[model samples]
Target: MFKVIFRVTTEVRNTAGLREIKRAGFIPFMAKREGEEEVYEALYKSNDLEELREAITEAAYFLNKVNRKGGNNFATIYKVNDNYVGKGLGGLLGASLGLKLGGIPGLFIGAIGGLLLGEILDVELNETFVGVYSWPISIEQ
Candidate 1:
């Protein structure tokens, strides 16, 4: 298994922002530095290096998009953060694709497409208002 750390920087310190990170399945740690508010430090772990990398990428993408509008404007100042729970979901998905699918190329294309779809669904479902959305729900009988 591979372990990775990601730092998430935001403009303000509040529960709403932290909740977003937590809901995404990340282990969030906050620290208040001189002349700065609370900043979130997130950690992500995966079963493989590739999966960890992919999770970092996905989490970065999600964080960027979430902060793009007008509020938080969080940026990844340091390593990619994926140690949270939602981030784990992304890593698991990548690992599954690698194991069940064919090669790296295929996995890359599939993950990108999946991420796109996830964003669209997040918008189309009108769940973005509450900062919660459905993520590729699967049902088993």
Candidate 2:
């Protein structure tokens, strides 16, 4: 399976937009809101790009139909190589363990060893696509 990272800005706020994203097969993991600007980060899992596209299209349609007035402004999608996250997590864990087992020196040594092991174990060739929105949702009512 492949993982996709989707980011979008829309007038739809909070739980409302989250529901639509979930319906599109994306799990909303992170979100940031600054005044009127809301950016959402989500992860979508699919067998291939085609399937992911279909799901995205469906999401767009749903958003357009529901919001109508406040539609998507900008959207981006990327195929993610999730190994880096694992590597970082592993390194932190290793560093903590090392510190407990030894001390400051052990922390550095363990972190390096853990990071290397994480990199070796997690490698992926994922493509990235930017601004693939074919039909931008209307922001005007």
lDDT of each: 0.42, 0.62
lDDT tens string, model 2, 65-117?
65522334345666566658758977998899899998999999889988867
Error of 2 at 57 (Å): 1.1
Q: Quote the positional error of residue 59 for candidate 1 in Å.
A: 1.5
**Residue 138 of model 1, lDDT score:** 22
Model 1 per-residue lDDT tens digits across residues 1-141: 222233444464445545555555565544343333334555433335445444544555555544511123332323232223433445457556854686877677656655545433332333212111122112101
| Model 1 residue 95 CA deviation in Å | 38
Q: All candidates: CA RMSD in angstroms? A: 17.3, 6.6
Predicted model with the maximum TM-score: 2
Worst window of 10 by summed lDDT in candidate 2: 66-75
Candidate 1: lDDT over CA atoms?
0.42
